[model samples]
Target: MSELFDRHQAVLPKWLAIYYSDPLEITHGEGRYVWGADGRRYLDFFGGILTTMTAHALPEVTKAIAEQAGKILHTSTVYLSRPMVELAEQVAELSGIPDARVFFTPSGTEANDAALLLATAYRGSNQILAMRNSYHGRSFSAVGITGNKGWAPTSLSPLKTLYVHGGMRSRGPFAHLPDDEFIAACVADLEDVLGQTRPGVAALIAEPVQGIGGFTSPPDGLYAAFREVLDRHGILWIADEVQTGWGRTGDHFWGWQAHAENGPPDLMTFAKGIGNGMSIGGVVARAEIMNCLDSNSISTFGGSPVTMAAGLANVAYLLENDLQGNARQVGGRLIERLRSGCAGLPGVREVRGRGLMIGIELVKPGTDEADPEGAAAVLEAAREGGLLIGKGGGHNTSALRVTPPLSLTQEEADEGAEILLRALGGG
Candidate 1:
């Protein structure tokens, strides 16, 4: 083991998971590549779970940060911040919620926490509905709504959460059903669960693509159908877009747009990519719900000028360059390439996800049992081949996660896929 690894184990909590058995220390990054401390260059497919939305070392974001730092690094939320208001206006416009208001946080966990607070307070209930196999965040409130057992370290929660089905399509009771039938089954199940809950269930929170649950997602319009039921009960719908937002999905700017027929969600939380590796996360809600809180609250570092500056520049670059369009064109090709390449591999179970956020599920050769060992081996082999990937699942860690920066190119995609294919024993 390396000295740093030994020291990490000695000082850090054992539960703070590290990626590889021999963990990596990435010191610097440029474009789609990041360098380990020992000077090994690796193609970064996961991009810190898709936090680096645009290319690394993009001059626009770096310059913005530098300029803002030169002026003032931080000013707490008590005073009006120009960059923060500008960013809020842009996000509020993109949010699609009528009369939208935005609240910033330093990370997605706090963003989701704030969303929960607004929702529960507005409806006067601590009851929340979540999806099975979903992973929200690590906070006490966020984990309470998270359905993945491996990520939830605590059973004690402030809110009463109900776990509903339909996040995973590979092995659920509805898995064998056709698309329409599957949607019906999940809706039926959701209705059944809501039937048992008390009158004041606040909201049904979901990740359009379940990030740490291995990028599992339901068919399009599934949430729209659920929205109908939620509307009947006056329960709000909160979309957690931490790993799925900001055009990563290619076809849409927000994952909930996949279910546009029912209109925008009552609340939405986003992070990871908005600030292009800067610490930025936020919640957007209609004015009515956002103003429900009676007490005054502030986020000291949430919308600080520096982070907001990064957000503004990053967003401008994304829009000006049409990186979402790039994700659509290149991501489509990459997924098809992976699906076609891994089709005959006995250890491969399914290739799933939309646009830049993709997952390859590993299974036993002829059975549906999760092959976490196989996934781990593939990850290691990919690293040896000068590529970096990630592993995640509901509890088994049986899936390979591919969430590259939105600026990924056709060449990078092809290169990463070739390395991944070799690692998976396909080449």
Candidate 2:
């Protein structure tokens, strides 16, 4: 092991996972590529778990951060923050919630936690409904609602979290059904779960695309169907758009738009991409629900000037360049290229996703069993071939996640696809 790896192992928590047998030390990055400590450059397909929204070292974002740092770095929420308010205004307008109120947090976990606090306090209930195979964040409250056991380390929670069905469309009992039937079955499952729960459930939290659960998602209108039931029960719907926000999904600006039959969600939480690589997460809610919390709350570093400046510039860059459109055009071609290449690969179980958020599931050649080892091997091999990717799944982390930056170009997509195919033994 390298000296840095040895030091990391000694200092970091044992449960913190690192990629590859010989872990890479990324020294710097530019555009869609990153340079390792040893001066080797690789195409960054995963984009730092989809956090690098625009690109590596984006000029606009870097300038914004630097400018803000030159003036001020840290000012607690007690003071007036122009950048924070400006970014919040942009987010509130973009968020479809009417009369939306935005509260910034440091990360997606804190955003979800704040949402939970608002829901429970507003409805006066500790009961929450979370979809199976869903992952929200790593906080105590967030993990409590996490249905994937691999990430949920503790069962203890302040709220009564019920695991709802319909997050995963495949490998479940309902996977055999057609899309329409699958929707009906999942709605029925939701109804049954709601029937068993007590009165006054606070909210139902869900990711439009289950990010850490290997980018798996229900049908387009699944959440819309659930919204009808939630409305009847007066349970709020909180869309966790941490990974699927900012047009990453291509088809819709927000993943919730795929299921927009009823309207926007009651509450929404976002993080990851808004500030590019900066730490910025937040919850947006309608005025009434947001004002429900009687006690005053504040996030010390949630809306730091530098991060908010970064967010403003990053969002502006994303909108001005229409990165969402780029994601649609390039990602559509990339998925088709991947599908065509994997058609004859027996170990490939399924190729699924929307826009740039794609998943390639691996299984034993002739069986339906997950092949996590195969996924890991492909990851290492891809790195060896001058490409970087990531893996995740509810089933033993057997799915390869292919979420490149929204600014990924056609040439980069094709090149990365070729490298990935070779890693999968299909090139």
Candidate 3:
């Protein structure tokens, strides 16, 4: 093992996952590429778990961070903060919730935890509805509602979490049905689960696109239909947009918008991509729901000026450049190209996802079983071919995740696609 890898293994938790059998240490990055400690440049397709929303080392974000750091680093929520208030205002205006309020956190786990707190408090119930095969976060509160067995470490939790269906559209009992019928079946399943549960279920939290579950998503309008049932029960809808937010999904600004017939979610949690690399996460909710917490609460490092400045610049650049349009146009072509390339590869089961977030599922040559070893092989081969990617799924970890920065260009997309195709053992 490399010296750094040995040190990391010695210090970090053994369960903390790292990619590849031989982990490569990235030294620096620029644009859509990164350089490893060995001084080799590689195209970055995963964008550091999609946190680098814009290109790597974006000048605007770096400048903002530097400027903010030159000034005061933090003032805490105990005092008034201009950057915090400004970013919160921007988030509230964009959140689509009526009379919205915002609270920032340092990571998505904490953001989801805070959302759970708000929902349970607002509705006076500790029961939460979460989708099966979903990966929320690692915090105790977040993990309590996580349905992915691999990600959920312990059964012990503060809340009683009930697993629901409809997150994973493929490989389910209803997968053979048409989109409309599939949605109906999932809705029926939801109703059935609700019927068995006691009254006052606090809320139903979901990721419109299951991020860690290989970018899986339900049929369009499924959540809208579920909204009707949830409304009757007085349960809030919390959209976990940690991966699918901020136009990463191309067709919609937020993933929940894909299912928007009844309107915006009651509460939304976002983390990844907002700060372009800086640590920033938060929850946006209607004012009434937000104010439900009677006691005082604050996140000490949540809205620090440095991170807020980075977020402000990152969001502004994302909007001004119309990166969402770029994602739509470039990502459309990239997925099509990948689909064509994988058509004849027996080991390649599927090429799926929208916008800059894509996934490639591997399987045993002629079997339907998940081929995690194949996924690992492709990760190693992609690295050897000068491409950086990621992988995730349920406990099997059988799908390769391709979430490049929204600012990815046509040239970069083609280059990364070719590398990935070759790595997949396809021409």
* Best candidate, lDDT: 2
lDDT scores of the candidates, listed in order: 0.93, 0.94, 0.93
Clashes in each model (backbone N, CA, C under 3 Å)?
Answer: 0, 0, 0
Which residue pairs clash within candidate 3?
A: none
Superposition-based RMSD of candidate 2 using all C-alpha atoms, in angstroms: 0.7
Writing each residue's lDDT as its tens digit, candidate 2 over 1-427 gives 7999999998999899899999999999999999999789999999999999999999999999999999999997999999999999999999989999999998999999999999999999999999899898899989999999999999999989998888999969899999999999999999999888788999999999999899899888999999999999999999999999999999999999999999999999999999889999999999999999888877799999999999999999999999999999999999999999999899999998989999999998999999999999999999999999999999999999998999999999999999999999999
Query: Which pairs in model 1 have colliding backbones?
Result: none
Q: Specify the poorest-scoring 10-residue window by lDDT in model 2.
A: 293-302
Model 3 CA lDDT for position 68:
93
Q: How well is each residue in 22-97 modelled by candidate 1, as lDDT tens digits?
A: 8899999999999998789999999887899998898999999999999999889999899999999999998999
Stretches off by above 4 angstroms in model 3 are: none
TM-score list, all predictions? 0.99, 0.99, 0.99
**Residue pairs with clashing backbones, model 2:** none
Error of 3 at 82 (Å): 0.4
Off by over 4 Å in 2: none
- What TM-score would candidate 2 get against the native? 0.99
Candidate 1 has a TM-score of 0.99
